[model samples]
Target: MKPLLATLFVVWLSACGAPEPATPMTQAEAVSIEEAWIRETPPGAKVSAGYMRLVNAADAPARLIGATLAEAARAEIHTMFMQDGMMRMRQLENGLEIPARGQAALKVGGDHLMLMGLNTALTSGAQLSLQLQFADGSSTNISVPVKPAMGAADSHAHH
Candidate 1:
């Protein structure tokens, strides 16, 4: 009987070893952003692009509604798509949504942020401060690193 009791005690200890569930963060802290970067602009360019990964850890969906930056006169969420065999870009005024426990990526040749009417040219190795606003009226301030496009030889001439 003593041996059986010891075995039960060991089983109970193993069950207790399981980790507890993580505490839910507030609405302001539910969104997690990572890998924020701004594309370097060519000389005299007035426009550029920024990219990042947005994760929603809350139980409800989160929307990235708007953005602000001192370096640009206006910032907008945009998406690039193929229409009639031509690439077209459009503003996403309604914003982008990330489902609960899911993520959305702002990437090249896809959904991204458009920084228009840049006050100055974006140079490599510079840090850009951006404020991202959500639909719930909560905002997150992030510092994005300026760098050339990764493994891409694209020019900002069209921008």
Candidate 2:
């Protein structure tokens, strides 16, 4: 009887060690984004910048092919690089690649989404909607708030 009880206990422990069910990946659920925001621009400025960290949790690498925003006449992926001792920004035609299980950052003075021909001032605390297109025919709509540039000194604060 003790031998049978030990056998049953071993079987129960083995069952507990079995792997959990794998979660299905949905197009709507595959990608995750963080720290998405649009920088606050001065009044009457023609262009502003958008920044975010795009995370690809899927099994395959993903590409950000394009983006659209209602507040701007046009939106394009851009990269900033030093050329001939000058900082220059240019549109990326091929799209930004985000490796599988990795992240791509669109930050200030680096890779960013350029919003041109602004329809209105991007004031602080205002939300902006953006649609991002991916190579896998998946798209995501994100709402980002406009915030002051990071590390900008407050002018109202006295020394």
Q: Pick the candidate with the highest TM-score.
A: 1
lDDT of 1 by residue, 82-149 (tens): 77886778889899998888999998778989999998989999998999998888898988999988
**What local lDDT score does residue 80 receive in model 1, on the 0 to 100 scale?**
83
lDDT, each prediction: 0.87, 0.82
lDDT of 2 by residue, 1-159 (tens): 999999999999989987988865644356787999998888987788889998888887788978898989998998877778866788889888888788899888789898888988899999988899887677889899999888752221110
Question: Candidate 2: lDDT over CA atoms?
Answer: 0.82
Show where candidate 2 strays beyond 4 Å. 1-28, 152-159
Best by lDDT: 1
